[model samples]
Target: MSDNKSNLTEYLTPLIPLAPVLSVKSLSFVTSKTKKQQSILGCSNKLQLTSGRAAIAIALEHAGIAKNDEVLVPAYHCESMISPVHWRNATPVFYKININTSINVDNIILNITPKTKAIIVTHYFGFLQELTSIRAVCNEHNIILIEDCAHAFFGSLNNQVVGSIGDYAIASSMKFFPCYDGGILASSTRPLGNVNLKKPTLIFQIKAFFNIIERAIYYKRFGIAGKGINALLKVKEWLWNNIKSVSGEHYTCNSPASSDGGYGLEEDWIHKSTSVASNLIIKQSNTKLIIEKRVENYQKIHEALSGLTTAHPLFTKIENGFVPLVFPLYVDAPEQSFDVLKKQGIPIWRFGEYLDKQITEAFCPNSTALSAHVFQFPCHQELTNQELNWMIITIKKTIK
Candidate 1:
């Protein structure tokens, strides 16, 4: 049992712990300071929700889309992105994404029908989609445009931020910032009138605060004493499991129920505002510094992986003013490579792999290939140079 436990400890690194939570002092400072200037898209009258999916649900409700109305979504997407449409009893039209993860404009136009009420354009992996062309198509067809910037919190294209491009845009603030939970629903033309979201319960807020603290400690100590920390976490997990066996509580400390993705917007939480902790952290964070560090990390990985025989980066260059969420690499044997990384406890993500079968069939061959091949590596602000170097080296070795 001890040997098995030791072996398990080798594969227990926390996934993507870059965004550090703010301290109470920092939160107080942030709240006391003057509000930051708004982007080209005004910042007033924004509605915050429990998660990005909730934001989408509100946007759909605001657009007045009803049952039998269709909303076009990319085939290369997570379940959370499409689930809201289904929850509304509306049909979802899945469009194909090209090799670069951008929507095939032609395919999207082809998929549009008279019943289509709205089109969701996602800026996948923080790379901007060709919004100009898509926007024109939406106008011509009289369809509402909802830009999904969940992966792109603060990036710009042609001097305009992504959220400004669509009629209504939704972003997952928790993805980019060190927040326990947050989602923003903003509009370009009009104010998002009272969403009626309530404040998160005090218990929920307390759990979030402690989760953030645990994440911070894990990240701060990983570089110095990763093995020791991981061992302790394993012991805790074991003790918790034994307790659960005796009490039949089934409680897990690793991932809480609140952290799970929502299939539909709950009436209780859909109107709930972003947690105070999340709002304060976002207000306190240095946007410029976060963008620069992420860009820098992405470039470093790109330089290292370029021209490799076994794998190559999807988007070869980072455009000006773009802040990437991850460094996407297309490996020849993604399954094998992924397994190798998993054993070593390296954090990697593969979107679109677990998509619905109907979506996979409707989309093009490119979507299928991308789903099987692409792996998203960490390029966030918290990673040390040494960690980045180690990741690059491990990826090269794994792919080869």
Candidate 2:
């Protein structure tokens, strides 16, 4: 019996997801009349692209930013955020972020110069960046303000939704919602221009649908059934690889590359529109319920970890109407904790790992520390109380 208990504890559990993908049953109820969909469409001249990077590329092009122009970007960011600037042949100037992950406006102003054309501010981990001062500075300098709301699709500040605040804003719907692929670009002052985007190939659409189905199965099945599903997935991969090798076709089975810098922009996919199935998934989702549940889960974890000495949550309190994308914890040894949680099969992520190596500690010390130390846990609406408790207890045991 003791051996059985040891084995069970060692057995890797599947990841607890941050969002719930759409199930087939939910598809029947999809409609365009939901308040969320209406609000998203009404924001401005909107363009839906294959991914957030694509949206940024389009926004830069439409704004008349040309090669050799400088665009200020927060140092603490994913490579995808920086990749679009390269795609446009624009230079990226890194700015420091404060302890709360908001941009230091002083650093931004210092970085701006005659060649500066735009500034991109990110609402890190869904906490709103205080944008009024930054906007004023941008206005003073005649620099375009672009809000990176990739982590803040539904978040609002002072009653204005994230995408509405900047001269141009972009978001990754896949982060906040269950859609397989989506990117949104919105502007208050100008049209998005006539971007000729072709529909994604049928093969791409089918692959996306299957990916969502696989996530659904992972969420629903357990024990032998779950193991069986995983085994089947492996076999499918093997078969697909063989098919690709024999067919002598370069057809890839996954969604388009999201952040290849500027390498593959000539491909038909760079101008691809969001999938119809993705649109349907978002149209049918309950925006209010999603926000409330995410807040509840985040607060529950925050309260549980408040007094712990081994690790500290980045945000201790949840503000009204703020929906968190993840619960970020700053720990003493991030690499060790990440390995422990990963071994236990907890779905965890660290965006710091994906930061471009070109960004040095000298350029942005605070962002460097955050990149190395902050670990993000799943706090999306999909997690139940029991799962949240497991994650909290696991961290308490491992971090010390």
Candidate 3:
């Protein structure tokens, strides 16, 4: 990264997250759901883990991917998606995506070799896409199809759900629900068989639950409880600092790398089960309301931006039988507008901003252009009208 861009990133980070955090308002939304939530996990064979990348690792392991095997991954991807391939000591061959971010089947076919063991298809931004053609190619080549649904937990196409069409599917529950962390590995065509998982300790479980509420409070999303959480946090910080000072122990936020947390996958936490709190929240989350609110927010943002000259919606309209994770808009001269929007504290992100070193602009023009120009804005269920407008209005002012 250029020194200027690196400095900007360091100084201007998003105060809020891309995912929904637990708040009193979100809790109320959860209780309103009466139906047992429906999702891709209704499949017969499924396992819950600490994070989506862990599910990916388990998927690769179960598929018998090992050292020297080659996996086909999209050129446009987050590190988490690519890390699992490396974790298995496998090489990932990059494939291109369409300008719309859909998989380029031609690239997939051209890159295939006898060493190709698996191909991962991501349902980018919760857009439900039919996998019939891709599945046909996978079958012809005897390649395992791994569906990456990190951005989408619910959706269907042609009577098949998002995760069911592939040999294995992975979902990041925390992104869709107001939970701390959770992920699921599932398959409809094959049995996951049996694998042991170590339960998280009681202390970790307790903190995981409270941390969600704490995050919400920090964002002032907890209404009247926000002040109380802040006050208690101040007192806690004071006591912690004084105690550490007296003991001559330096304070640090550093923790050992675990598969249960952080960006890259850690082998140690691969077998760790999702925290009880995350599972409970996932179970009780208002699936119906989530779909409803997300669709509403997505359409609203699209409508607001439809008239803008500087940017345009990636998908002219939301697809049927699906909900959106975020409102993706393509802005012209992102070099000019992207940082301006970020400096204004917009909860926006470019998924493939920093891809594998092997990936280049010449190698994947669409991915490179996207990483530079496409910005994703949150459209989660928890966003209020005022909050949504703040984002939309700020985007308009800056993008102009």
Candidate 4:
């Protein structure tokens, strides 16, 4: 048994994740000589594509969604998330996000009409919940279920990962581990339909390449360039909104290439993963070890601030080793708390604005209340303990 175990360990060692693709430190270069080694070869029983968005679009298209089908979607998602269903000529039935947990789809199920064909579930901000009830409902109704694991990877309930439980699973690789752009669509019930992988046009490819380079440069010099770009974009937006007549060239400026920072048209699939993303994955380095550290810091902060302030951990108990995408703090007086925090240089946010509409009426009251009053603080992998301590001190000083 010992010899067999050793052999198994040796064989599986290379397959384990090495490191996070995006890091605060200079771990690898985009033009590194060893970058190309990470490209996947041949297809699997599952479909893997150049980008997560494209993968979801293709999966939905293959699922027989016609022009009149109604696809239920989480209202809290970005506009870009609904493109797949729209591309299939389907109507987007907006559903409310459960605020308290950011996991349940109570709002969506209640609003389901006869036209509803599928439900897209986002494991919001990495919080996993008991989905047995939701799955049971879908099974009973015969509605196709698609798990959107864009913010969640490897999260499980009752020994089943989110991706494995649904009729189909859509995962955005870039969101989790820093791959440039890629998605996985896997199905057990229905064989994924045959389809050709279309490469973005060459011009789009070249433009996207440059945009990636530009972003890298911007992020690397975030102290200056990041701020400058943000300020300039803000000013541009202000001008466009206030001076509509002068914005007559809006159509020209809003063309695809200009809007997307010169990315190529959406027809090519070069299948080239970014060097930065690949190197981060292959080196199996300790860059993401920072997330573990952040989790520890969050525990200390939560314990210290739990009763003194309204902020709380949404999960029953934050799962061990899971990185937090945001630390949500519910305040008694959101405006007051926000003002106090802002005066102290602590940036806080309320994120569920998209769920305030008609369809959102179906969302949980607890979620809605929390969403309206909660302020999210940065808990990204790179945050330092000292920074967290300072933030806590500032919050206490200002709130009281």
Each prediction's RMSD over C-alphas, in Å, is: 6.0, 6.2, 3.3, 12.9
**TM per candidate:** 0.83, 0.85, 0.89, 0.63
Q: What is the lDDT of residue 157 in candidate 2?
A: 74
lDDT values for all models: 0.73, 0.73, 0.80, 0.53
Candidate 4 TM-score versus the reference: 0.63
What lDDT, from 0 to 1, does candidate 3 have?
Answer: 0.80
> How would you encode candidate 4's per-residue C-alpha lDDT over 175-291 as one tens digit per residue?
444344455666656676566555444544444444443454433424455666667656866875677677554432121321221222243332323233332342442333434
- By TM-score, the best candidate is 3
Put down candidate 2 lDDT per residue, 1-400, tens digits, no spaces. 0001123345365466655555443334334443453233457688887777778888888888889999998888776777778878899988888877878988888889999999999887788888899999989999999988777777677877777768888887777667777888888777767777788888878777667657767776243576677788889889988998999888755556652112234344557888877776766676666677778888888888877787799876766757788888888777677667768877665665556676778877788888888878887766667778998888888887
Q: How close is candidate 2 to the true structure, as a TM-score?
A: 0.85
**Minimal lDDT window, size 10, model 2:** 1-10
List where candidate 4 sits over 4 angstroms from the true fold.
1-21, 24-55, 75-78, 81-83, 94-99, 102-113, 178-195, 199-294, 320-323, 337-350, 359-364, 390-400
For residues 207-244, what per-residue lDDT tens digits would candidate 1 score against the true structure?
Answer: 66656656766656344465565577678769867988
Please rank every candidate by TM-score, starting with the best. 3, 2, 1, 4
Clashing pairs in 3: none
Clashes of each: 4, 0, 0, 15
How big is the positional error of residue 219 in model 3, measured in Å on the Cα after superposition? 1.9
Tens digit of lDDT per residue, candidate 3, span 208-313? Answer: 7667767788677877868887888779769877999899987453211332234667777677788888898777776787888889999999999989888899
